[model samples]
Target: MFRDTQSSWMSTLRHDVPASLVVFLIAVPLSLGIAMASGAPLAAGLIAAVVGGVVAGALGGSAVQVSGPAAGLSLVVVDLVHTYGWRATCMITLLAGAVQLLLGVFKAARAALAVSPAVIHGMLAAVGVIIALAQLHVVLGGSPQKSAVANVLELPGQIADLHGPKVAIGILTITVLAVWTRLPRVFRAVPAPLAALAAAAGTAWAFGWDVTRVDLSGSFTEWGFPVLPQGDWHLIVASVLLVALLAGCESLLCSVAVDGMHGGRRVDLDQELTGQGVANMVAGALGGLPVAGVIVRSTANVQAGARTRWAAILHGVWVLVFAVGFGWSITLIPLEALAALLVFIGVQMVNLGHIRKVHGHGEVPVYVVTMAAVILLGLAEGVLAGLALAVLLALRRLTWVTVRKRDDRDGRTRVTISGSLTFLGVPRLTHELRTIPYGAAVDLDLNIDFMDNGAFEAIHSWRLDHERMGGTVVIDELHDEWYALAASGARTLPAKSPLKAPDRWWLPWAQRRRGAEPVTVPPDGVSECLVTAGTREYHRSTAPLVKPIFTELARKQQPSHLFITCADSRIMPSLITASGPGDLFTVRNIGNLVPRRGSEPHDDSVVAAIEYATQVLGVRTITVCGHSGCGAMAGVLSGGVRAGSLPGLRRWLRHGNHSLATFIETEGDRLHAGALDVLCRVNVQQQLENLRTYRKVDEQVREGKLELVGLFFDIGSARVHLVPPLRPTLCVKPFDRPVVAGEE
Candidate 1:
C-alpha cells in the first residue's frame, strides 16, 4: 500500500504539477480577456478561474478538463451588466447555478446534446462577431459603442484618429499571437497569450510609452456580496434559465470533446453539470463571473500530459497565490494588449471547420438564419428561430413523395411509389394514379418507408375503383408493409414498430412469403428442381424490380472485388457482403484454396481467374473467405483419413497441409478454440500467402495497385470476421484482431 501510494504521488508530481503550471499560464490571460470583454471587474475573472478550478475539478466527472471564465459567455454577461448592475448580475448567476444543479440531479444532461449543432455553432459565431467589434475599439485606443451596429458605424472614425502608443502596443500583441504557433518548439513551449502579454508589457515599460494599464487596485478591496435585481419577474426568470441552459450545454459539450482527446475515464455529463453549477454558485457569491468548462485551458491541460483532476485543482491554487501574493504583476499588462487578445479569440470562435461541417449536413440555412438573427436581435430569439426553421425542414422532408410510372416489357403498367406517404402528398399520389388507364393491368410497387391514414385511404380507394373497371392490380410492398397491413384490416395508427429490413428476393421463397399458403408439387410427379422453381419465382416477383439496375450493367461489368470463398451452401457471398449483381466477381472451390504458382498437381483454373480479374478487369481487391466447420479443413486435420476412399479428394487435401502444420504450431496460443476452427482460420491466411506467390499479384501489391483481404464466416452466429495475411518470417496469430462493422 505504501509503495502504491508513493508511486501515485511520484506520477502526480511528474505529470499533473507541470500540467497545472501550463494551464495556469493559459487560463490567466484568457480569463482576464473574457472578463474585460464582459465589462466585469478584472478581479472577477481571477476569482472565477480559482473557483472553477478548485470546485469543478474536484467534483467533476472528467479527469483532465479545466474550467474557468469563457469568452463564449462574454456577450451575455455584458448585456446583463448593462441591464442590471454588477451585484444583480451576480445574483442572476447564483440563481442560474441553482437551476443547473436541479437539472443535473434530474439527469437531464444528455438532453442538451440533442440540440442541432448548426444552431450552437451559429450562436457562438454571433457572440464572436459581437466581441470582436466591441474589443476592436479598445484595441484602437477608443471606447466601444453600445451595440455591434453602432461599433461598425464608428469604426472608421476610431481608425482615423488612433492613439499611436496604445495602437502600437495592441498591434504588437496581435502580431506576436499570430506568429507564436509558427515559432520554434522552444519559443512555443510557453502559452501564446502569456508570451504576447509579456512582450507587450515589457516593450511598453522599456520605451516609457503612455498607455493604459490594467487597474486592479480597488478590485480585491471593494468586493461585496450579490444582491437581488430590480426587474420584471418574467424576464428575470427567462434570464436565469438561459444562463443555466447555456452554461450546462457548453460544459457538457467540452466534456464530450475532451473524452475523444484522451484514453482516460469517460466523463459522466450529469456530474460535470453539477460540478459547473457548484463552481458558478461559489463564483457568483464572491462577486465574480459565472464559471464553466473552458476548451482552450482543457486542451492545454490534456496536451501537457495531465493524468488526473489534480492538474485543474492545482492550477486554481496557483491562481489564488498569484492574485493575493503577486497582485502587482498583473497591473503591468496593458489594457490594449488584453483587448487585442480578446479580438483574436473572438475571431477564432467563428471557426471555418464548423462552417464546413454544417454546410456538409445541409444545415447552412439554419446556421445562417441563427447567426443573422442573433447579430440583429438577441440570443434566445435566434435559437427559437433556428429551431422553427429546422422543424419546418424536417416536416417538408417527411411529407415528400415521388411516383414513377412506366410500361414493362410484358405490356403491363408499373407504378412505383416511394418516400413517406403523408396527407401532404395525397394530391400528387392521386394524380399519378389517375393517369393510369382504367382497364389496364397494373403492378403497384409500394417502396415507401412510412404511411399515414389519409395516404392509405387514397391508394386503397383508387385500387378498388381500378379493380371494378376490370383492371387487375397486384400490390407489392418493397419496404414496410404499411399498405398491406391497412388493406388486411390491421391497425395502422401508431406505426411505432422498430425498423425491420424487408424481405429480399435473395431469401428462400418459403421465408419470403410467411403467412401465405405454401405451394405444393403435383402428386403424380417426382420432386421438382428447386433451381427451376427459384428462377420462375424470380421472373414473377423480382425481375421487374431490378430490371433498371440490370439494364445499366448488361453490356459490361466493372466489379471492384474478386471474392474467392468455399463452395458451402450456407455461404452466400452477395448476401453476406450486402452487395448486388455487379459488385463482386466470385470464384468458389472446395477449401477456398489458392495453389502456389508451381506446386504439385497444378491447377490452372484459379490462376486463370486471378489473371483475368486483375489484368483484364482491373479489380482493386482480392478476398479469400473461409468459414466455420469446413469439411475440407476437417479432412486435412485428420491426416487424409477422411479422404482415404477418394483419390481426387486426397489430392485436393494436400493443398491444405501447410495450414494443418501452422494450426498445430500455434495451437497453444488459442487453447479455447477447437482444432477444426483453428485450422479453418489458418487456411484463409495460408491461401493469402499462396496468392502472393504469383508474380503479377506480388508486383501489383508492392506498387499499391491491388489489395488482398481475408474473411472468416461463422455459420451459427452469422458473423463475418476479417483475417489478415500471413508473413513467412514472422508468425502472426490468426483470428486475434477485432471485427469492424461491414459496409453496405
Candidate 2:
C-alpha cells in the first residue's frame, strides 16, 4: 500500500503538475474573455473558472476533462442579465443547477444525445455569429448595441470613428493570436491566448496609452445572496430549463470529445452531468457566471499529458490563487484585448468541418434552417423550428418509395416496386398499378424492405382484378416475402429482424428465387430441365460478370489442384474450395477409385488422366475426396449384393475389396461408427495407396515433388475434413484438431 501510494504521488508530480499549469494559463484568459462577452463582472468569470475546475474536476466522471466558464453560454447569460438583474440571473443559474442535479440523478444523460447533431451544430454556429458581432463592436472601440441587427446597423459608424489606442490594442491582440500558431514550436509552447494578452498588456503599459483596463478592485469582497426575478412564472421556468439543458449538453458533449483525445477510462456521462450541476450551483452562489465544461481547456489538459482529474482540479486552484494574490497585475491588461480574444474564438466556433460532416449525412437543410431561425428569431424558438424540420425530414425518408414500370423483351409488363410500402405511398402505388391495361401479362416484382397492410391490400386487390379480366399476374418478392406472407395469412417478419444474406448467382436456382414462377418456358419441352434454365440465367446474369475472366483464360487452362471426388451432384468443388473458374481440374467417378498399376481389372482411362494431370499439366496436389452415405461404399459393405444383377457393376466392386479388408481388420469389432461409414473412409486411404503403386507416382512422392491429400465431406453437416496418408484412424473432429485418413 505504501509503495502504491508513493508511485501515485510520483506520477501526479511528473505528469499532472505540468499539465495543470498549461491548462491554468489557457483557462484564465478564456474565463475572463467569456465573462466580459457575457456582460458580467470579470471576477465572475474567474470565480466560475475556479469553481468549475475544482468542483467539477473532483466530482466528474471523466478523468482528464477540464470544466470552466464556456463562451457557448455567453449569449444566453448576457440576455438573462439584461432582462433580470445580475442577482436574479444568479438565482436562475442556481435553479438551473438544481434541475441538472435532478436530471443527472434520474440518469437522463443519454436521452440528450438523441437530439440531432445538426441542430446542435447550428445552435453553436448561430451563437458564434452573435458573439462575434457583439465583440466586434468592443474591438472597434465602441460599446455593443442591444441585438446583432443593431450591432450591424451601427458597425459602419463605429469603424469610421475608432478610438485610437483601443482599436490599435485590439488589432494588435487579434494579429498576435492569428499568427502565433505559425511561430516556432519553442515560442508556441506558450498558449496563443496567453501570448496575445501578454503582448497587448506589455505594449499598452510601455506606451502609457489611455486605454480601458480590467477593474477587479473590490470585485471579490462585494458578494451577496442571489435574488429571485420579478417576471411571468412560465418565462422564468423556461429560462431555468434552457440554462440547465444548454450547459448540461455542452459539458456532456465536451466530455465525449475528451474521451476520444486520451486513452483513459471512458467518462460516465450521468456522473459528469451531476458534477457540472454541483459546480454551477457553487458558482452561482458565489456570484459567478454559469459554469460548464470548456473544450479548449480540456483539450489543452489532455495534450499536455494529464493522466488524472488532479490536473483539472489543480488548474482551478492556481486560478483562485492568482486571482487573490496577483489581483493588481490584472489591472495592467486592457479590456479591448480580451474582447479581441472573444472575437477570434467566436469566429472559430463556426467550423467548416462541422458543416461538411452534416452535409454528408443529408442534414444540411436542418443545419441551415436551425442557424437561420436562431439568427432571426430567439435561441429557443430556433431550436424548436430545427427539431420540427428534422422530424418532418425523418418521416419523409421513412415513407419514401419508388415504382418503375417497363415492358420486357418477352411481351410481359415488368413492374418493380421498392422501398418501404407505407400508407403514405398508397396513392402513387395504385395510380401506377392502374396504368397497366386489362388482359395484359404482368410480372409484379416487390423489391421492398418493409410492407404494411394498406400496401399489401392495394397489390392484392389489383392482382385479383387483373386476373378476373383474363390477365395472368405473377408476384415475385425479391427481398423478404412480405406480400406472400400477408397473402397466406402468416405473420410477416418484422423489418428490424436480423437481415438475411442477399441472393447470389452461385446458389441453386430453387434457393435463389424462392417464390418466383416461370415467366416463360422454352417451346422445345426442355423447360423443366434445370440445366436449360441455368443456361438462360447465365446468359442474362452470370455470363456478363465472368466474361472478362473467361477472356483472360481463353487460350489455355492451368489449374492448381487435380481434384478427384465421387460423382455426387450434392458436392460442388468450386463452392467447397471457395475457388473460381479454371482453379480445379476435376475427375469424378462412382466410388472415387484408383486402379493399381499392373493389377487385374486395371482402368487405363483413370491412369491416363492421372499421368496427364501430374506430368503434362504439372499439377502439384492430387486430392482424393470421399463423402458420407456413399452408395458405392454401402454396396461394398453388402458384399456387392446390390450390384449382383449387372456383371459390369459386380466387376467394378472389386476395386473396394482392399478397403473392405482394411476396415474389417482395424475397425470391424469397434461399434464406434456405422459399418458403411467406416468402409467409405477406408476406401479413400486404399485409393491413395493404389496411386502410390505406380512407379511415376512413387518416385514423385519420394522426391517430395508431388503431394497426395485425402478429403472426407460430411454431406449432412456440410463440412470438409482433411485425411492424412497411410493412417487407419480417420479423424472426424473439427479442423482445429489434427486428423488422420481412417480415424473416426
Candidate 3:
C-alpha cells in the first residue's frame, strides 16, 4: 500500500511531459495576447506558463493539469496596476501567496466552503463577459478592447489598422485548422497548430506580405538569456490576488474532474491552492503573468493518453522552443481566429438554465448573487453571499425554539420544552419568544440532552432576548457541560433523518434516472428489534448482545438498567450493547425501560438490570436510552402504539415513559415533532430510578462512581445523544443550546 501511494506520485512526472507539449502548442499565442491585454511584457506570459506548468507541476497535489498566464486574471491585473501601482500589487501577490501557503500548512481547505457559491458564479460570469468582449477585436482583425462598449466603439480601429495580408493569412490558416480538427481518424492525429502555423507562415512567405509578429527581442539576450520585465513590489501584490483566485479555483476544479475520470482519490484542495499560490508568486518574480489550471488542455492531455509527468514537462519544453526558435513565424498569423475560440469558451460559462432553477427556490438571494457575479464582476462577493444564505438556513434549523404552552390550573399559561437546541433552531426560538401571550408567567421548562456550541451560544443570546421581555425562561435539566466541550463534544450534530426530514433528493432522482428498482437486504435486525422488550424475546433469536447478558443473568449477575428500544427487528442487543451472553444481565423493552419511583411495573425487567448491575454483576454506568423515533414513542404520541394494541406494551410502557404527557401538561402549544428526539431522551432519565426500586441500585450508586446515562437513538439519523449531568433538573437535547461561539 505504501509503495503504491509513492509510485502514483512518481508517475506524475512521466505522464506530464508529452501532455505539456500539446498544451504548449495551445498556450503560446494565448500567453502573448493575454499579457498584451493586461499591459504587461509579452514574455511575462510565457514565464507564467513555465512556472505554472513546471513549478506548479513539481509542487502541486495532482500529477497532471496545465497552468499559465490565464485570460481570467487579465482584467484584475490591469485594474490593480492602475490603482495600487504594479510594485505594491506585486507585494500583495506575494502576500497572497504566503497566505495560501499558510492556509495549506494549517489544513484550511474547509475555508473554501466559506466562499459563497453566488460569488463564484459572479466571478465566472464577469470573466466570461470580459473574454467575449476582448475576443471580438481579435475576431475582427484588431487589437483587443476592455468591454462590450469598447469592442463596438473600436470598429474603426480595425479598419484603420487593417493589415490585409495578415488578415487573409490568418483566415486561411483558421479554415484549414478547423478542417484538420474535424477530419476523420487518420488526419485528426496531426496537431492543428502545427498544420495551421506551417501553412500560414508558408503562405505569408510565398506572398511576401507585411504582417504583425511576436516580439521576442525583449524575451532573450546574449546566448538566449531570459529577458525579464522590470516591475516593483506593488504590481506583484495586485497580480497575486487575481492569480490566487484563478489558481485556487482552477486547480481544485481540475482535481475534482480528474478524480471522477480516473477513479482516483480526491485532490488535496489545500495543498493544490498553496502550490498554485507559490507557483504564481514564483512566476511573477520571474517577470511572468499569473497562472491557473486550465480544463481544456487538461482534457486534451487526458484524452491524448498521457500517463506521467514527462508529458507535461515535454509540453513546457515544446512551448519554450516554439516561442524561442521559430519566434518570428507567429507574427504572420492574424488575431481574429483566437478571439473566436475564446468566445466559444465564454459562452459555455454562462448557465442560464441553472440560474432559472436556482431562482425557483429563492429568487431574491439568487438575484443578488447573479448581480454580484455579472455586474460587479466580483467572484468572491457573490460566492460569499451564497454561503451566507446557506449559513442562515442552517442557523435557523439549529436554533429552533419549541414552546409548548399548556393551560394552567388557575387558567394561567404553562410552558415546557422537550427537545434539542442547535443553530438551526435559532429562528424558531426567536419566533416563539415573540409570540408569547402578554403578561403571562411563561413556565419555561427545558429538558435538552443534545446541544452544541452554536445552539448553546444562541441560547445565551436568546436568554438576553427572552429576558428583555416579561417572560421567564426557567431552564431545567440543561446539559451545558456536553455543549461546552469544544470539538467533538459528547453529542454531535444530527444528520437529516429519512424518518424525520425525508429530504434525500439525490436518492430518488438517481433511481428514477437509472430506471432501476431498489435492492432489498434481509432485515435480520433493524428498528423492530430496537423496541421489542422482554426477557423471553432475548432468548428467541440468540442475538449477539442478548447472549452474554443472558449468560450473566443466568449466572446471577443482574444488569442495573432495563434497556428499551425499537422493535425494528434489526437491532441485536448483543451487537449494540457490545456484550456477550453473560455480560449485560439485561431486560428488553420496546422503548428503553426505566421505571419512575412511583410508576407501576407489570414486568420485573426494569428491576432486573438494577439488581444485576448493583447486586450481582456489581457494574456501574446504568444507561437507558430510546432509539430515534421508537415506534412506541410514535404510538404513545399518536395514541397508536399503546398497550391496547399490544397488551404487554400498554402495560409495560406505564413505568418506562411519561415525558410526552409531562410536556403536554406543561407546554403543548409550542411543542412540535422536532422534540421526538428529546422525548426519548427524557424517558431514559425518568427510568433511572425504576432501577433503584429494585433496591440494589439505590445503595450502589451512593457507594461508587455508578453513573446514569440517558440516550435517544434515531432509526435514520446518524447522531447519538449523551445527556450530561444536569442534577436536580432533567434536560433533553441540551447540547442544542449555544453558550459560546466555537468555544469547544
Candidate 4:
C-alpha cells in the first residue's frame, strides 16, 4: 500500500501539475466572462469555479474532467437574476442542487440520455446565440436589454454609436484569441485566453483607455449567503426544477463527450451527477453561480496530459489563491476584453460539425425548429418544439412497411409483404393488391409479424375475390403464421421448431452465397446419397465456376502425382493440397500400409492403383501420407485387431506387423503418453520401404521416373512432418519439412 501510494504521488507530480496550470489559465477568463454575461457579480463565477474543482473533483466519477462555470447556462442565469435579484437567484440555485442530489440518489441520471441529440444541440445553439447577442452589447460599451429580442433590436444603434477605446480593446482581444492558434509552435503552450487578456491589459495601460474592469469588492472578507425568493411558490419550484435538469443534463453530456476523447477510464453518469450536485450546493450557499462540467477546461486538461483528478483539484486551489492574494491583478483586466472572450465562446457552441452530423441522420428539421424557437420565443418553447418533432419521426418508423410485386415464370403473380402489418399499412397493401391481374394465380408470402384486423380483412377479401374469378391463391408464411391463425379463429398455437437447411458441404467457394435457400434432401437408399451430392454440386455451386476443368477431365485424365493416405473421413487430399480437377490420383486404405510385392497375403486394390498411376498415367511422384490418431495403429498397439473374429480380416492386417514390431523393440514394456502416436509415425517409414518391394517402383526410383516421399500428419497440431529415410540413398530434399496443414 505504501509503495502504491508513493508511485501514485510521483505520477501525479509528473503529469497533473502541468495540466492543472493550463486549466487554471483557461478557467479564470471563462469564469469571469460567463458571470458578467449572466448579470451576476464577477466573484460568483470565480467562487463557482473553485468549488467545482475542489469539491466535485474529489468525488466525481471521471478521472480527468475539470468542472466550472459553463457558458451554455448564461441565458437562464441572466433571466433568473433579472426577475428575482442575485441573492434570490442564488437560493434557486441551491434548491436546484438539492433536486439534483435527489435525482442522483435515485439513479435517475441515465434517463437523461433518452432525450434527442437534435434537441440537445439545438438548446446549446440557442444559448450560444443569446450569449453572443448580450455580450456584444457589453463589448460596445452598453448594458444589455431585458430580453434577447430587445438586445438584437438595439444592437444596430449600439454599433452605430460605439464607444471608441473599449470597442477597440474588445476587437483587439477577439483578434488575439482568433489568431493565437495560427501562431508558431512556441506560443501555443500559453493558453490563448490568457494571452489575449494580457495583450488587452497591456494595450489599455499604454493608451490610457477608460474601459470597465473586474470588480471583486473585498474578496474573501465579504461572503454573502443566499436569500429566499418572494414569488409564487409553484413558480419558484418549477424554476428550480428547470435549473437542476438543465445543469444536470449539460454536465452529464459533457462527461459523455469527454469519455470518447481518452482511452483510459470511462465515466460513471450517476456518480458524476452526485458530485455536480454537491458542488453546486457548496457554490450557491457561498453566493456563487451554478456549476457544471465545462468542456473547454476538460479538453484542455486532457490535451495537457492529466492522468488523474488531482489536476482539477489543484487548479481550484490555484484559483482561490490567486483571488485572495493577487486580487488587484485580476481587476486590471478590462470588462470589454472579457465580454469579447464570451462572444467568441458563445459562437463556437453552435458547432457546424455537430450540425452536419445531425443533418446526416435526418434530424436537421428538429434542430432548426428548436434553435429558431429558442431565439425568437424562449428556451422552453424551443426545446418543446424539437421534442415534439422527434416523437413524431419515431412513430412513423414503427409502422413502416414494404410491398413488392413480381411475375413468376409459372404463370403466377407473387406478392411479398415485409415489416409490421398494422392499420396504418392497410391502405398501401390494398392498393398494391388491386394492381395484380384479376384472373392470375397468386402466391403471397408474408415475411412479417403483428397482423391487425384491418390488414387481415383487406388481404383475406382480396384473396377471396381473386379466387372467385377462376384463379388460385396460395399463401406461404416464412417468419410467422399470423394470417393462418387469425383465419382459423385460434388465438394461440403450439410453438414449433424452425426449419433447418439441408447440408451444402459440396459447394465450392465461388458458388455459395450467404443465407441462400436449402435444397431438399432425399430419403436414404442405395444410390440416394450419391445422387444428392452430385446434383447439388453441379446445379448449385460447381458448374458456374470451373465447367471446362470438369469437361476436360471427363475424357482422359493425366495426374502428376499419386497420393496414398489412410481412410480417415477427416482427411481430404484436394482440400489440403489446394488442387482442383485432374491434379492428384488418390488411393485410400486402412493405415496407409503397403504390402510386399510377393507377400503371401496380397491386396490387389493397392497394387493395381500404384500400377495404374505410375505406369499408365506416367506419374512422377508417389506420396504416402500417414496421420496421427490412426485407429489401425492404436489397434495394433493394443492387440485389438489380432483377434480371430474373422480369418480373412486378420490375414489382411499382416502388413502392419512390422510397425508393431518396431514399436515394441524401440519402446520398453511401459507405454508412456503418446506411445501410439510415436508408433504411427514409424509406420509411415516402414510402408515406404515396403513400396520398394515392387521391382517397377525400385527401378523407377533409380531411373528417376518417380520420387518417393513419406509424410506424417499431426491432427492435434494441424501440422505435417516429413519422415526421414533410414538411409542416405533416397533421392529427396535433404532438409526436414514441417508445414502448417491447410495453408497454401
Q: Can you give the TM-score per candidate against the true fold?
A: 0.73, 0.69, 0.49, 0.68
lDDT tens readout by residue for model 4, 281-400: 988899888988988899999999999999999999999998878878988999999999988988988999889999999889889998989888887788889999988877766567
Q: Tens digits of per-residue lDDT for model 1 on 660-722? A: 778878784344547788789999999988888999988888787777888999988888887
Those runs of model 4 whose alpha carbons end farther than 4 Å from true positions after fitting are 404-416, 439-449, 466-480, 492-744
Q: Which candidate gets the maximum lDDT versus the true structure?
A: 1
Predicted model with the maximum TM-score: 1
Count residue pairs with overlapping backbones in model 4: 0
Q: Where does candidate 2 stray beyond 4 Å?
A: 1-4, 404-416, 431-450, 465-472, 476-511, 515-744
Provide the lowest-lDDT 10-residue window in model 1: 735-744
The candidates, ranked best first by TM-score, are 1, 2, 4, 3
Q: TM-score: which is higher, 1 or 3? A: 1
Badly placed stretches (over 4 Å) of model 1 are: 1-4, 402-419, 427-443, 447-449, 462-472, 478-480, 488-490, 504-569, 572-655, 658-744
Model 2 TM-score, 2 decimals: 0.69
The Cα error of candidate 1 at residue 238, in Å, is: 1.3
Each model's lDDT comes to: 0.86, 0.85, 0.57, 0.82
